[model samples]
Target: MITILNSDKNEVQKLGDLKPGDRAEIIGFEKAPVDFENFLHRLYEVGFLQGSILEVLQEAPYSRDPISIRIKEATYALRRAEANLIQVKLCE
Candidate 1:
């Protein structure tokens, strides 16, 4: 996976890199997956839009395959693979 450096010098981190209680702003997606278009559509439809605020609420106890996150007032679980595709600018 590719890590991005923000123009303002703030660290850009992958959504999967965040731990519980971490908050960030969605920036963009990284290397496109096979169904990139659909992925983007689904993410946007579910409120994973750019500039949206995201908070990591929990992670699976064992494999951590699915991570629970909050966006606005809604919560959703995303697989590590899908999370990695999302790039975010960490909130201080």
Candidate 2:
């Protein structure tokens, strides 16, 4: 049986809402108005595009900065703006 995981409503509000210890799968990405395709391609090159698995490692206290996350075998820090483009399905 395929079971869908429940996600936090607030945390899934936007890409910037992801927090530490959250497990999620990338579902889609929001296209930026300027340089939209370029932006998407860049994210794909960095392993943040569609079908990616993400694990939040840590977030800043202010919650207005970058966040540390794990993708595949690499850990990366992304600014709030960049993260906001990546949509995800939170894993329960």
**Runs off by more than 4 Å, candidate 2:** 1-13, 35-37, 61-64
Which sections of candidate 1 miss by over 4 Å?
1-9
TM-score of each: 0.82, 0.74
lDDT of 2 by residue, 1-92 (tens): 99665446324445567768888888887867786678667778989866778899888677547888899889888887878888887866
TM-score of 2: 0.74
Model 1, position 44, has a per-residue lDDT of 86
For candidate 2, give the lDDT of residue 90: 80
Local distance difference test, each candidate: 0.86, 0.76
- When summed lDDT is taken over every stretch of 10 residues in candidate 2, the lowest stretch is 5-14
